[model samples]
Every structure is written in C-alpha cells, then in structure tokens.
Target: MTIRFPTLSFAAVRAELLARREIALLDVREEDPFAQAHPLWAANLPLSKLELEAWRRIPRRDTLIVLYGDHAGSDLAPIAAQRLAELGYTRVHVLEGGLDGWREAGGELFRDVNVPSKAFGELVEHERHTPSLSAQEVKALIDAKADVVVLDARRFDEYQTMSIPTATSVPGAELVLRVRALAPDPATQVIVNCAGRTRSIIGTQSLVNAGIPNPVAALRNGTIGWKLAGQALDHEASRRAPEAGEANRAVARASAQEVAQRAGVKCIALDAIESLEAPDRTVYRFDVRTPEEYEAGHLPHFASAPGGQLVQETDHQAPVCGARIVLADDDGVRAPMTASWLAQMGWEVYVVEDHPTSARQVRGAAAPVHPDAPVVDEVSVTELARHLRESPGTTAVIDVTAGVNHARRHIPGAWFAIRAQLAQAIEAIQPARRYVLTCGSSLLARFAAKDLRSLLKARGSEAEVSVLAGGNAAWFAAGEPEESGWKNVATPATDRYRRPYEGTDAPAEAMQAYLDWEFGLVAQLAADGTHHFHVI
Candidate 1:
C-alpha cells in the first residue's frame, strides 16, 4: 500500500509560518538527533512515540503537519507519514528532501530544544532593552542585606535543585500577582533569575511590562553566570512566593490587562468560546495556574501549563505554530500576562474570563485521547512475577518505556527496547518460549506488544507474546523487585535530549556553551525570517 502524503518545500512551509497559517513542522526523529540540529521551529515527535503523542500534541486532525527524519541508513518520515495517515490525519506532508533538504534550502538551523522561545527572549531584551545586573552585582546586594528580593522564575523543582542565595521561587506567571506579597515595599529592588537567561529575561520583562511598583532587573545570564562568577548556590531550598492579598490581586489584574492589550491579546468570556473555536481552526485551551491549583479544579478540556514553562517551551506545549491559544487563570493576572508574551511570539492568543469553581470543576490532569490498541494477550504483575521465578529464562521481559525511565527503574532483568526499533531488539535477545512487554502504564507496551507479535510472525516463529497487565508502574506498586541503570540496553537511548541547563551535574563548559548559544539566537531568528515575532 502506498503511503500517500504531499511533500512541502522549504519555501512553502516558510510562507505558511510567515502568513500565520498553522503548521506543525515535526522532526519525526528521536529527541537526541532532533536536538543536535533542525529548522528553528521544528518540534521533535519521535516516530516511535507518534502513535501515543500525535493526537495529543497536534490536537487538530486537519492540521498542516510536515514531517522529516532521514539519517544515513534510516528514513523515518515516510513511515511516520503512514502512521499519521492511519491515525486519520488528512493533511500530512513530508518536508521535501528531509533535514538535508532543509539545510540545502538555506534554512537556519538551531541546536537544542525550544529555540523559538529562547530566541524570542533574546529578541525581547534586544528590543525592550530589559534592564539587568551582573551576577557579581546581585551577589553584592545579597551580601549587603540591601532592600532587595530575588525571585527565581524557573519551575519550583528547578528552584529547589540549586538556587541563588536568598532567592524565592516565583515561577514566571506567578510573578506579577505574587511579587507584591513577597515584597510589599514599593522601593524594594526586585531581581529575577532562572537557571539560564531565557526565563530570567522573560520573567523580569514580565514584571517590567506589567509596571510593578518595585524597581526591577534580571540577574544577568542567571545562575550560569553565578556559577562562572565563583558564587555558591543554595541546595534543597524550599522558599516560595506567598499568596497575594486582595488589594495586590486587584493591582496585578489591572496591570496585566493593560500589558495584554498593548501586546494585542484578545479577551473572550466563557460564553464566547464557541465563536473563538472555529471548527476550521485549532484553538488550544490551557489553564496557566500552578499544577496544584489546576488539579484541584479546572475547566473541562483545559490542560495545566504553568505560565512560565508555557512561555519558555511553547513548542513543546503547543507544537502547532500559529494555532490560537486560550489561557485561563482564576485570578485573571497569570493568563493575561502569559498571553502578552505569546502574542509577541506571533501566536493568536486569548485570555478566558471565566473562573473555575468546585461546582463545575474537573479534577486531576487532562488525559490525552489515545486510539484503541488491537487486542493482545496479557499477564498480570503477580503472574509475571511467578513466571519469572518459575520459567526463568524461557520468558524474556522486554521493557518498552522511554530510555530514561528504563534506566531509572525496571523489572529486575527486563531489557530496554525502543518500540520503533523493536525488530533489532528481538534479533539481539536470544530465542525464547515467550516474551512479556511492559512500559510505564502499559499504554505504550500494549501498542508495542502488537508490533512484537507481527515481527515474530513474519519470522515464522511460534513464540507466545503477552503484555504486562499494568506495566512497570504496577510492578513497582506491587512491591516487585526492580533494578536501575543501563542494563541490557539493546537500543541506544536516543529518545531523550539531555538539557544542558537541567540537573546540577552539567559541566561548566556545557552551561557556558548553552549561554553562548542563546546570545546568537537573535541573529539566527533574523536569518530564518519565518518567526513573525514582535515586541511591545
């Protein structure tokens, strides 16, 4: 059967991006290669996980999806196009000539993930000239016990990992509303910092844009600069911003509204949602509150995306560039502030006026809709444990979870295998009487079980195949013995991109390189000319 899909040239896709026509330029390769280099706007959707992620990430079935993945001997885009076609996506296309074609077409390539947001941060500073203070300057202020408040604009976990001395966790979206409570005095010098420059710049700019009463500036180059300056950081810090008072909330709302209006963000009430969501277009509804707040109560169909992370990683949150985005927050401050940044990033953004209440609230995370998997044989955790104990080597357990997860924990001797490269894994593992497949929740394992069956059948092997009833999570929940580390890694763990800014163990050189790369993103954006970004 021919896998039918159109081929889009670089010029064509660029036109769509510039025109504000929605398109998801997906690099259907694992995160590792996709991170090394790709078009500035390309989002990573590894072919192996496409079945599980495509529907959720892309959202709209008719979205203009352009995929490309072609390495020396492996070509994944065609296979990915077929898979998307099977999933009922009608407007799929392959980037003409794959990544090579993109480079040949003179496309500006960027390294690392979330290039759009990072580059936009640099551009924001360039255009707005967002004020900043060097790490040494900030350290001196802390040493002097001056009238200053340091706000960390990264996720709470990231702040807890390693933070500047005396810094409080006030993630991006929470800054405006919570800052007043943290620093009631209008003259207090407020300094913002993140692990690196992007969030720091964006968070500081957010305060500046919202007209916060206190004098504000970013900790230049963020923590990376702090480390380079020979400063020690606090570890296991638990400090966070306090809740805002009613008066502070009122002031924040007014300021955010003005900033949003300046950035050209649209506002719509709950009742007008139908009009905002045209069937012909894609509209993403995100609740830009803390995850805890969102899980307690949120509007149905609204996914939780903390405002700061949403701005820092827009490509990951909403891969369909140019799609309409609707942000929600009960306080009315976070949503509008987030909308302001997204609007300048060239997204048609909106802030929802309706608030979530317990009367009509939906609890917990928004689960993605997944296609039904073909029926396959299954073995429960207890049964698998018994089989492993009794049958020994006859039943080989293959763990099909993400490499990082597999390395972290797995059933004692399960071999790690990527679902896309299952055949290679099967060939490497010795012949067995039966095979048991599992993953985090068994969701991905169920799909992989079907693939394993077909591969075994094609080779004319009569081995029995089964999926672990609830996968690794169930196994762990049942007190089953687990092992850690890269044991029996049959396939390279290319599914994840190791972020240079994450984890305290990152080398100084790598962190400096990451900072160096950010400094040049503005020039790259200029060369690309596809990002229709602006600054207020």
Candidate 2:
C-alpha cells in the first residue's frame, strides 16, 4: 500500500494565513515577480538566496516558515522547504496555490511594487500578442538619432563580451534595484535587453510596471537576435558601481536599522543574553557576519547567519518560539537588522555588544563548530583539502553561483547549482561522492556544503561535503587555472518560462490579512505558556 501525504489546498492555506496571529510570509519568486506587485508584508527570499545567503538570514531552527511562489506548480516551494529543513527548520510549508491561488480565492494582491515586464509578460501572453521592435525599427530609431538608451539586462560580464552597440548593462531583477543609478534622465526611452526573450521580455515590462515616466521596450530578442540579424554589437562595458566602501556598508547598515526601528524592533546584549540560558530555554545564537568574517573568526557560541537572508527567512533560522535569541556581528548592521526582524516576530532578540576582547576571544577559543558538525565531530579546511588531493576521482565539485556567473566560468566538471535549487539538485546526485561547493566567494560554499550534507542524510543518503578553500574569488585571486566569464556562451533556455499576472484588490486584502494573522500570533504564542517570547 502506498502512503498518501496531505496536501493543503489554496483556500486552506489562505485561511491558515488569515487565522494566524503571527507568521512570516516569504515569497520565493524570481526578482521580477517581487519587483512587480507582491502581497504586502511579503519579503523576497528568492530561491537562489538559499545557496548564496541562506545561513545569514535564517538563523532560527524552528521559526514558522511559509513560502509562496509565482506559479502554483513553481519549484520554489519544495526547494525552499527542503533547504529550510536541512538547515534545521521544523515547520515549513508551501502556499498551496501560490500568489495566483490567493488571488483566485479572493485574497488580496498589491501592485505598487510589481515588476511591469513580468506583469506585461502575463498581459501580453494573455492577449497572445507581445509587441516587439524589430532590429530594423531599432536601427531606424538609432539612425534617426532618437533619444533612446539601450540597457542590457544581463550580468555585467555577459554585457562586456557582446551586446547591442546602443546598450548599457542594467541586468534584470537588478533593474529596479539600480534603476535610479542607471537612467538619470526620465525622459529618455529605456530599451532593456538580455540574450533572448524571457529577461528582455520581463525586464522591459518591469520598467513599465514601475511606471517609469520614460518610455521603454525590450530589444527584440536581445543580443543573440541582434547578432543573427548581422547587426553590429558593442563589447565595451564597466562596473556599474565599482566603489563598494564604507559608504555602501553604512547605507546597508542604516537601511537595516531603519527598517527595524520602524517596526518597533529591539536588540539584546551578551550579559542579558546569558540570563535566558537554561535547560528549559531554547536559546539560538546567530552570527550575522559575512562567511569570510565568520570563518576567519566569530563568537565561539554563535552559528553563521548572514543578515539579508536572516531578515528574509526568520522562521527557518529560528523555529522554536519563546526562545532567547542573540545575534552577533563584526559591524552592527546585520545584527541590528536581524534583531529588528526577530523582534517583529515577537522574539526576545539581542545584538551582542562590542567588547575589546571580542577578536581575541574568538581567535583564542577553539574554532566555531559547523552547524552540521556533530557535537564531537570536527574538521578544518586544511584537512579537507588534503583529502581532495588524495582522492580526486571520488570528488565532485559543485559551483553554486548565479546562473549567469556559472554559465560564464566555473571549475571544470563542477555542476552548477543555484542556492535556491541546491536542495533539489543535490538530491539527484551521487550520495557516496565527496563534494566541494563554491560561489562568488567561499563563504556561501562553506555553508552550502554543510547544508547539502544534512539534506542528503535526511533522505537516507550519506554524502561528505566540503567547501572550496577560498571559493571562486579566492581561486581566481590566487591565479589558478581559472576561466573568465567568456568561457561558455550558450544562450539561456527560455522554453519553460511563464509569467502570470492577475489584477485585483487581492493585494490589499492579503496585506491586511497578513497583519491580522501576525497580530493574532502574538496573542496565541503568549497564551501558550510553554513558549517564552521576547521582542528583538
């Protein structure tokens, strides 16, 4: 006899959300879905975020985690649930019908933040007629000297290799995030491009969704089509914002702090943190610093938790409610931001205060244990590297980077797995193989290898996982046999692409319902004496 698992329907999930007193609503859609309208109180934890920055945002092992995606059949739900569970979350669920289901059920939806192109894609597809500007039309505009700026919505590396001569790199998903910096002149028509249809289709519509005053459209079929049409393309490109210094850190920190304060969030200190520790108390300490910083040194008692993801995935990080929570950071930015979100969840959240001996303490103490490392188990990079050198054939190298980055250059034979997709990807691989995971930097790779092993074990598979000593950046900086982003140049696949948009008052309803659900959770958790609660 086959066992049947319970599957919650859309109405049921929506009802659960409506009845909840407190819950974290995470949307695991692509950046485009999120940029276009999303349910109010919904935060983007793009499926890719898991591999790249999971440990940072989600430090709690038992926080209630509910995720939704664009399509009902979207792969994000299971992927997120699996990753969260591997990371130690006890209760994670997918929204039964995704955003569309909620809307169809008369739930609320919001438009202010919606990405126009995605919405437009749905609209165009709904009408079965997406207007396109032919190369001739673009050339006519260029020859006529029209006031237009072509924006390549691919990554900077891709833009550098080849792009429409009239275009500048603006990368999809990043378009809205960095729009203001790209186009200062609102009057100028913006032309978004990617290698082919999806991103260009989505990027162009995103600008329109955001209500950009300037007229915008995607370059018909992007650079690939442009090249096929025998049109000249430009190879010149530069870093959009090369200066990532104190100012940028300050901005990120300030934004985090502001968000926390606006939400009435608070932080706890170390001494105060100690008071809550007891056999009955479920205390979770998260180190919200960069992987490099955490690996180099971190609070002896803390686990790695990156800030951005911590905010986006609070419940997955901390599952048990009524627990004393402490967040540590070299710079106060991540800690405060994390504290703010946890506080919103009604947890007693605290940021460890600075101490002169902090650095010395971390360095002098035994290295922090990996989250997946058993109580008595210990391993180091040096030991792992030695194993790699000794057993090359048995080893598997997995490059967990942005699709664009992985496509350009990766360790030879390294399988590409975006963070959000890692759980699923790993499940299909050889469990007996030793694995090394990498991303832009080794930090995520380190965290990912540990998490991947946990997932494999949960499914009755045993896999040994290790991190690239320094990740791709480190590999390149050390001058290894590295390939530039120009190594592989296949056009991305667009056959499975689908963007759905449904207009309604559902966003407004969903937002209020979400707020009501959270408000109720505070009361419910408080009434449950077994659970101890504190505002971070």
Best by TM-score: 1
Candidate 1, residues 1-536, lDDT tens digits: the string is 87667899999998998888889999988888889999988998888788888888888898999999985478889889999999999899999988888899899899999889999999999999999999999999999999999999999999999999999999999999999999899999999999889999999999999988889999999988899888999999999888899999999999999999999999888767768667768888898999999988888788899999999999988999888899898988999999999999989998987554653378887877779876889999999999999989999999989888898989998999988888888878888999999999888888888889989999999999999988899999999999999878778888888988777778989989998899999989888888888999
Stretches off by above 4 angstroms in model 1 are 354-360
Over 187-304, each residue of candidate 2 has an lDDT whose tens digit, in order, gives: 7767877654546655565455444566777777555556555677666666452222465455445555565565465555566776766644566777765455577777667776
Question: Cα deviation in Å at residue 278, candidate 1?
Answer: 2.5
Off by over 4 Å in 2: 1-48, 51-65, 68-93, 97-138, 141-231, 237-390, 417-433, 455-464, 482-536
The TM-score of predicted model 2 comes to: 0.41
Q: Which candidate is the best by lDDT?
A: 1
What TM value does model 1 have? Answer: 0.97
